[model samples]
Target: HTGNEWGTENRAELCFPQLFNTSCKKPTTPLSQVLLFHILMPSMSLLTVTLNLLVIIAVSHFRQLHTPTNILLLSLAAADFLIGLLFMPGEILRNTVCWFLGQLTCSLYNYISFVVTSASVGDMVLISVDRYVAICDPLHYPTRITERRVKVCVCLCWLCSVFYCYMIVRDDLSQPGKHNSCFGECIIFVEFIAGFVDLVLSFIIPVTVIVFLYMRVFVVAVSQARAMRSQVTAVTLQLSVTLTAKKSELKAARTLGVLVLVFLICFCPYYIVSLFGDEFLNSASASIVFYFFLLNSCLNPLIYAMFYPWFRKAVKLIMTLQILNASTYK
Candidate 1:
């Protein structure tokens, strides 16, 4: 028996140390021990979750802020919010003890996990596609990215995610006492299908499109950089030649490139681990990695606030309005 068979199959059944004892077999406890780790992990999760909720509610309540891009952001917030609320808390509970809830709760947990995860993946893909259109086809973007089209796209994304998760949830529900065992295993085929879909839809498709789009973006950037450099060089030939345009364009391109690169760097490891089924096969590391991926949701709002001018302004405006309203009432 594994050292961590302390929980129900449908829920986690052990504490963090017990669950991960095997992974840290060589380690001796430090002064603080696992206490610090536990506190920090849950705190981070809560912080990210609360911020995401604030952003989502703030955006939803403001009609002037709604747009095609914001719609995708709202969808992403919804997915991330559910992930933090429904999934993470249950997982934490499971890890610390036996499954307090029965099969019904277990099924709901699994279903919500599947749905939110799928939706998050779909939102990433949509954002990538949206960026490609905005950057590559600026002139036609207004016509292509209609509000109705975005709504349809968001709806389809949810539908596909729900349908994808349904099979797994249904399969689990079909077999009574199937999850009664002391493991989190679902039907093997269901696991297989979920894994395959995750690989294809989340890892494979999004990465492919993002890579291709960024490649084009780079080429265009280089071409534009060269043109600017050439013009600067010509002017410099007549003057001191100290000032440069190539360097500035290069800086902007590099900044955008780095942002995209950071996203991939942060996310790629989890997906790579995901591709190997064994990583998540009743392993405690899977839970940790799952939370690591969820960190991206928190990172998303930061990304938008930093990189997207409109989002930054919107956030600022909302905050300003709230402060004024509070002051006025006071």
Candidate 2:
């Protein structure tokens, strides 16, 4: 029982003064850390929620934006929104104060965390597959990746995530507080095998699929670019239109490649720590990795804002409160 079993503390203050003998010491969170948790976390949460909500509104409100690819963005935005709305605040609450939310709430928090995370990962994989089809097999993409099929895949992704993560956290969900060693703590302890399986299914394999598909996509995209460039002098109006369309697809693959890259940068360390035994599971470095993982949700919408003109237009309409009166963004 390193000090971590009690949430990053090996200090003097008792978490529960009433049960002096059994109570763990509360961690002395620094003023900077407190300010960070108090000020920055809420701001991050609000920004995440607000930006992702704009994505949702933009994609859903504008019928012109309802392509299969945007549908996947909508799903990813939904998961990021939940992460901001629920998960970030939960971490802030548990860290800055006592776990007054109770055991059932904690279990639910962890459960939803897993579900949202798995779904986010699934969305990334789906996005990769979508891009792969769009770039590698462009002629068939329209028929292959219809809005209906995207919707079905989104639904199945969520269902499978729900079922799979349930198997991982079912014990804690049932027992409620089985993982907590003392009061004022909300701990998540998954079995080694389960954690490894999660690392493989949720992190490793999906990442492998995303990387591989995106690699093939980029290679094909680059080839398309070279072909278009070589044929630039002989371009007819129709060929120009065709070239422009291909360039659009290439740009999309580039943007989503950035998204997947950011997701990997954020998620890799967390799973890397998990790849180690339980000894490193609750360490301070692991805590940092966990925070890094959570930051991905906040950063995602920012990437959308940077890359997507529609996201910018939507944010403008949303901020001006004109979205209510608008018919479509375009």
Candidate 3:
């Protein structure tokens, strides 16, 4: 009777009964929750990938799209694309099922996740700086923010993300599953000191830089817009055209400011949770916050589609395969 009960328990709970004591238990989730997650997570992943891919193709295939600002955006989209394609699916699977992939795969996934996220934050900082220069120092913007310099900055951002994440997770990389307690589980915990450092570098510092720069950009942009409106009413035709261009730049800055604001709203909750410790929030609630964070990637391209006329044209061209024509770049 005891043997039969043990077998039933194993069948019901353990992910791998053959491994018995070493195996992890299967996650117990309600039918409604399971169905909801299955539908919701994959949809988020697909939308994120599809939307960011459009941005990637738009920036890469069109010669006219290759500017300093768009280059930063291209790098940002690439990181977001990876998040949707790789990290989201893995996160969904990890939460829903026993991890069957070996420990090394788990370690690498976490490492890449950190790298991509750090790169995304870095890209936002660069975008804010780009807008600040364009708005506050219009005369030098052309010479100061060139495509080559932007490309170099983007490359450096990615490299630093890789290096920084490696340093953070070096022990885990050296010995995969060192933090896991069972065969079917995958978990990594940063030490208190390391976690604190990560909080400052990854969350605090970047957010501070972004907020400060955008504040400056906002002030300058608003003042410039008011000046342009006033001058347009009194200026000669040549000066009127110049004011018109400045007004357009201010509009662009405002749109991108919206993007930055959305990013902060989505991002802050997750980091705030991290600061307090995951134990403070229930698992389900924490997962919801995380999904909200992931939702930003999907929203980004939608923002572009709504605000940028060029992105719409690029998508139309890409959909029709018109980009294959030799003169499409022209």
Mark the regions of model 2 whose C-alpha exceeds 4 Å error after superposition. 1-13, 30-32
TM-scores for the candidates: 0.71, 0.92, 0.95
Deviation in angstroms for 204 in model 1? 1.5
**Which lDDT values do the candidates have, in the order given?**
0.62, 0.87, 0.86
Looking at candidate 3, the ten consecutive residues that score lowest on lDDT are: 276-285
lDDT of prediction 2: 0.87
Please state the error at residue 248 of candidate 1 in Å. Answer: 15
Comparing candidate 1 with candidate 3, which one achieves the higher lDDT? 3
lDDT for residue 17 in candidate 2, whole number 0-100: 68
Kindly indicate the candidate among 1 and 2 with the higher lDDT: 2
* TM-score, candidate number 1: 0.71
Candidate 1 or 2, higher TM-score? 2
Predicted structure 1: lDDT: 0.62
Clashes of each: 3, 0, 0
What is candidate 3's lDDT per residue for 1-330, written digit by digit as tens? 699897887767888888877889997666756754688889989999999999999899888889898899899899999999998899887778899999999999989989999999999999999999999999999999999999999999999999999998888899999988888876656666777898899999999999999999989877887777667667588897788778778878887888899999999998888877635432655777887788888888898988989898888888898878833454
Candidates ranked, most accurate by TM-score first = 3, 2, 1
